[model samples]
Target chain A: MTKPNEFAPAWQVAEAIRSGDVPAEDVTRAALDRIAALDPKVNAFTDVTAERALTEARQVDADRAAGKTLGPLAGVPMAAKNLFDITGISTRAGSKINRELPPAEEDGELLKRLSAAGAILLGGLNMGEYAYDFTGENDHDGACRNPHDTARMAGGSSSGSGAAVAAGLVSLALGSDTNGSIRVPSSFCGTFGLKPTYGRLTRYGTFPFCDSLDHLGPFARSVRDLALAYDVMQGPDPRDHACANRPAEPALPSLNEGISDLRIAVLGGYFSTDGMPEAAAALAPVAKALDADKTIDADGIDAGRAAAFIITNCESSRLHLPNLRARADDFDQDTRDRFLAGAMLPASWYVRALQVRHWYREMFAKLFETVDILLAPATPFPAPLIGQRTIEIRGKEMLTRPNIGLFTQPISAIGLPVCAVPVFSGEMPLGVQVIGAPWREDLCLRVAGHLEKEGVAVAQAPSGF
Target chain B: MTMSDDDFDSEAFIRTMAPSLGLSLDEERVAGVSVFLSIAKGMADILDAAPVPENSLELASVFDAGQTAQQAKAE
Candidate 1:
């Protein structure tokens, strides 16, 4: 029997429930009990849907007893970043602005699908306000501290989702990635996070930051679990215009295919030049595992990053223009200032950015003809301390918020599938980002799994969980 | 497209543009806007140094056409 306190993968938990070795209700009870005892210190959940989770677990138990069909995720407890709408709960979106908004009449499409698949909703988690900043330091709601070391920051804006899963409070959780929201937290909190190809997962009812860049995905302790959750959440929704009108591809079956013949590349230049020795050091084993070839020049990367920033800021400003005009003071100083800067950008500049985006995408397409996946550091460095404004990297000082997404922003700009795998360097956690061509989530996961199997990266539950 | 350093603190320019753009700007809001404008102005200066292509066309519809092609393929 798996120890109650030990970190059990979601698939293992599901199998245990299926085999009747452990009842779904008993597992749910244990999870809730763990959350009840551990969450106050971890602050993983903003709301604990204890009553609803229990009621749902009971239904799963009743269904199992009747020999009814079980969903793939049957009776697993999961949470969404607070930005997602859970029927009857106001989607605060980690900001005070939406606090008084009416409760959602229906669960977001993602939530509804996950629930239909038999995953219990444990409630919404915390995030960076408006999902703007990368650091999980929420001023309105207290900053979600890193579970590994309380003084450190949980990478944002899916801070709580990352911390909760890493701390073993939940096996699976939903996180939105716009400029590495999911990947950063997963990297910092030491877990596996997947930012599927843009439009692969429906974004209906989820709050928008930058419609073009915003991607909804999963964070889990294992790559397989992330793939399982992603497979369930995928499929076109008529409601989301960005969603691709295609049938969902099976991600799990491909995970077992292995990466023997895959053409892998170590993204050099921009990816290799920056920050902490640990960040660069974490990539060596991944490169060796994949026998990755060096590619990607540094010249165009800055332009890619600049274009992504311009698009993110301009669209974000447009989204918040009304509130920014009405209640500018209500936002955190950082988010407010960034929005203000975005609002001042000229229309022509934004237009030029779009043109540049086209050129960059074509450039990536040319590169992908030779390589199936590109591996790079997820963040320039590991999670910095909360409230840190500047960090020293390679003897040069760098801004924390904007630079953290240096490697991540460029890839997301092109709408690639990226899985951030946490590599343990000594006591701290660092991550290597594996990016695949558009709609190649399975390839990304396969490569990530290869890294895990080869011991290139290891996932560990945060200490004192 | 070139802007001088003085453009960073163009409070009067921002105040005039704010209401025209439907933005709120009280004294405090003006101060915030000023700081932001400074950063934008700095970034804008850097961005302006690069020359634009004479035949540069807007790329918004690039994805739109590709999306249509993809949808047609799916059908």
Candidate 2:
């Protein structure tokens, strides 16, 4: 009976449990114990389902005794951002308003997929209110602290998802990325995150913020773990009308394929890391390691980013109009103010923004025709302090909330698949987005895998975790 | 849709539109919401300035009833 290492990647953990080196119950208990001990500091898990987790782990053991074939993720523990329903619990979606909603009768589509693939549910993690945030600060559940530095942010709406994985509380986490929710946390927490193409995964059974711009993804310690989770969750669900009518395209099979002849380039101009030395430093190593020398520009980037902001504001505010009208005072001041302003945006502005989105989508479609992958910084800088509001970039002070997503929003606006791979430099780690064309998630993952193998991108645990 | 007019009043727009949309704008939050609206206005201006060729684009539609119905039938 070997002790279960909580910090091991999901692939290794699953292999250990399958080989009888570690019992499923021990692995599950280890994660639960870690969450109980450290979650008070990280504030990652909003709810920990210890009893249910042990029951599920025992079933895995029982199946092994009967010689039944186990799933790939058998005996591995994982958690989802609270936005995903976990049956019998109120899907808080990181807002006080949703806390009063009826408990979900069933799990979300992604959770169900992960469960069927042999992953044990460790309950819901914390996030920003209604997934309408970049920083993981929630008025109801308190700020999700960065695992690296407890005083700083955990990059959110998937705040808990990233923090939980980085803190070794869980092997993998599920998160939603509307405009960098997954990537921001991944960058700040130094985890490998995948924001698959919009419509790549079904959005059914989860609370949504900007329906037009919202995306759901996974965060993990290793690139292979990210790909493994992604492979199982891929497929169309009729429940979510926005989900693409496409079959599952597994990236795990080709994950080891080296980037031999893939045309790679860095996005210049709009993605210029001018005056932001940390981001520039992070991208330089990734570009050099990949032998990527070409620098290209996407003309529609400015318009695309602007369009994302307008569409997000319009759609999210409209979705919460009823609550805004009835319980406006109950909402977080920052979230409430933004939604209120969003509601006032003219329909004409929204319509134009969508047109710009269409234009931007085509622009990327063309850009990918020449290059298989494009490289850019995931965040303009590292994670900011939890309560800090403003940051200075290029000698000009700007709002931290909106500015944090500058690099991420434009890419997600057109719904491209991007993998944010962390590059450990100085004290705090930064991330670089290895972006790919629509539905070419394998390319991004493959590059990330190469970087991980070369030690260029790594998810090193924070000290004393 | 252009925001060329420098005299546009964000507070006035909020006062008028919030009531129309059934959202009550409290005085304290009004100033805060107005600042957000002003930020949104700046972003909108960027979209206005970009030259989007007419023939190459359309609104990115999330729902297509006919296409969805056909896909469901096929499946």
Q: List the residue pairs that clash in candidate 1.
A: none
Best by lDDT: 2
lDDT of 2: 0.91
How far off is residue A253 in model 1, in Å? 0.4
Residue pairs clashing in model 2 are none
- Provide the lowest-lDDT 10-residue window in model 1 chain A: A1-10
Report lDDT (Cα) of residue A242, candidate 2: 79
lDDT of 1 by residue, B6-60 (tens): 6445577677777766886677767776766675555455444534456867474
Query: lDDT score of model 1?
Result: 0.82
Number of the predicted model whose TM-score against the real structure is largest: 2
Candidate 1 positional error at A6, Å: 4.7
Alpha-carbon error at A35 in model 1, in Å?
1.7
Off by over 4 Å in 1: A1-6, A293-295, B1-13, B26-31, B41-53, B61-75
Cα RMSD of predicted structure 1: 3.0
Report the error of model 1 at residue A457, Å. 1.5
lDDT of 1 by residue, A1-465 (tens): 543343788887777676666778888888888888987776768888888889999998898899988888887879989999988888988898888899888889998888888888888898999899788988788898889987888988999999999988888999999889988998888999999998899898888899878999998898888888888888988678788878999799989788988988788887774546878778877788788756666356766677778888889998898888888889987788778768867787788777777777788888889889888889888889989999977678977887788778888987899999999875779788999999999999998888888887778877788
